[model samples]
Target: MKTQNQITVTQIETIEQFESLREEWNALLFQCVEKDVFLTWEWQFAWWKNIGQWEYQLWILLFHEDEQLIGIAPLMMSQKRKFRFHFRWLENIGNPECDVSTIISIEPQKTISALLRYLQEKRQEWDGLELMEVNATTTGNQEILKTLEDSHYGFWRTKEEHFYIPLMGNTWEEYYNQLSKNMKHNLKRRMKRIAEMGTVSFKKYSGNSLTWQDFQTMCKVSEKSNFPDLYKSDNLLSFHKDLLEFMRELGWVQIEMLFIDERPIAFQYGFLFDNKYEDWRGGIDKEFETLAPGKLLMVFSLEERFKLGLRESDFLRGVYSYKTDWNPLSREFTNIQVYNTSNIKSKLAYWWVKHLKPIVESLLSKEKQKEQQNDSS
Candidate 1:
């Protein structure tokens, strides 16, 4: 490896460059002390191939020293509207199932300064820079934000609360006992009621081990449980299939199926990454709502995570009351927009959107209400 001061930044220009650097990129990414699966090449490439579809341009920046790869920032530029200037954004290309998306690398101490310098030098080429949906708890984010602030990049707030649960300890029983008495009682009561009806069982399988029938059943059940209309979208189904296959290849896929008397009732699809298990998707048979199969599946999955010696259980992006009952702390995230002063019009538009947009919307809403009242009278 080369010394820190000898590092060079190169923009990945083609798919060939990306492919050539895949192994080294992933190695450095995984070496980070608190890296998440979202930063994995499998996840990133899958997003580019499956979802990006030439609509966006990728501008990955690599930091290398003496022929040793150390850092990367996966960035994309996309046009929102004709009148609105294009924005350059950086993220992990995370799905709803993943948490904490941003520009991350193995050695922040060495690479962060180089990254900021590069962005600062290229400020005139891009309208703005956005790092969206970053997990506030991670030091990677704190360091990056501080560097950007010191570099005089524009900053704005987006969101303040994200929820996740911890899965620490040796056994499920011990972990469950940590919950409030009321939560424990409720979970037990639900399990007992479901058990009284028929023999209930749970199975965890991976994409490689799972048959095609298993995937079909999960899709069907999820469609029936969540949104039937959404299930019919061909792109969505294809995306799910690709995600499952990719996760399975990385040995991170986990499919938990719940059954009653040998009939499938509920199922969950999640991933195990960086010593943490994320509950990404799930579906339950609405007909079995009385049995609370969804709750049973979650309880079983939590236990299984503990059995595997994982450190955390993330419910992903959503905020639901049921998740809080498990005693996990909620974290806040930010959506940042940074721009250069050289692009005056673009900068003005961004400022209007960030600061004055809410006030404009509120006033418009009030005007609409008064007009409606006058017409009615």
Candidate 2:
């Protein structure tokens, strides 16, 4: 009913504006081409409340025609300090924690062009745009990058390996049989060993089934594990606790724990969104490393995922030896840095980072290698 000229693009700058748009925002996400649990309103809002600082300015873009919300670019503006220079940059609100970051849009190309044009109008406010953790295999994201190039946006990309398991077959047993012989035997042997040691219990908590106490237990296990000490920070703990509560309300969260005689050894925190089970974060107490509790937990979780008929299980970021053991298909995630070529400072910084930094890194690497060689001699 609305013409192209009737469509309006508005910038949401305050949390109040963001909250009021939640229903419509989620509705827009439901129809988006790229669907992930991280893109939800709950996740975005929670991230802003917990991880996001007051210094960062919110720059969420919303597009609507005939009062019907169509697209959203969930972004924020922040200052990046490098070598005594503070450069303003635009980035997605949830990063480092949220994987597969992307805009929520059915028409990605059109929406991206409009958002970019809007950004250009306010070019003075930011020196660059760093779109990180983009799933490289996604056609929509590829088109967005191409559009940026066609529009003469000065940008460069770096990639890292991302992995996921594509579920197949009518039953879990069928899928299990497809694994390599060594993996199959090892898993069975380890599980059997665990059973012999003590009563092994694998419990999965979903939705209302999970409680704050259960979450705390998982956190305790993570504290004892070899994973990065994210829980040690009160801010991160608060963020996750809040995030878990929000996701639980949506029936989107799942927590898996491996218990040996009621003592938790390993824990996996994940989400079920759009029929896919995504592995968010996990930890295994190294004290039980010889028992291979982490691997046992994963095996139990995979079997549960199969029973649930989930489409796939994404291990998210990082390429670990255990992930390779699962034989997951990989999708590369790219970090895109777009500079405002019109700005002198932005141009200089981009050149230094894109050109000079790599050369310096290579030289340093060679020197380190030589040092090691000389030490051995």
In candidate 2, what are the lDDT values of residues 254-315, reduced to their tens digit?
89999999899999998999999989888898888887888899888998888888889999
Q: Measured by TM-score, how close is model 2 to the native structure? A: 0.93
Question: In order, what lDDT does every prediction score?
Answer: 0.72, 0.83
Write one digit per residue (lDDT tens) for candidate 1, span 299-357. Answer: 88887778878888887676777677678788778767666656776667667877888
Off by over 4 Å in 2: 1-7, 372-377
Which residue pairs in candidate 2 collide? none
Supply candidate 2's per-residue lDDT for 254: 85
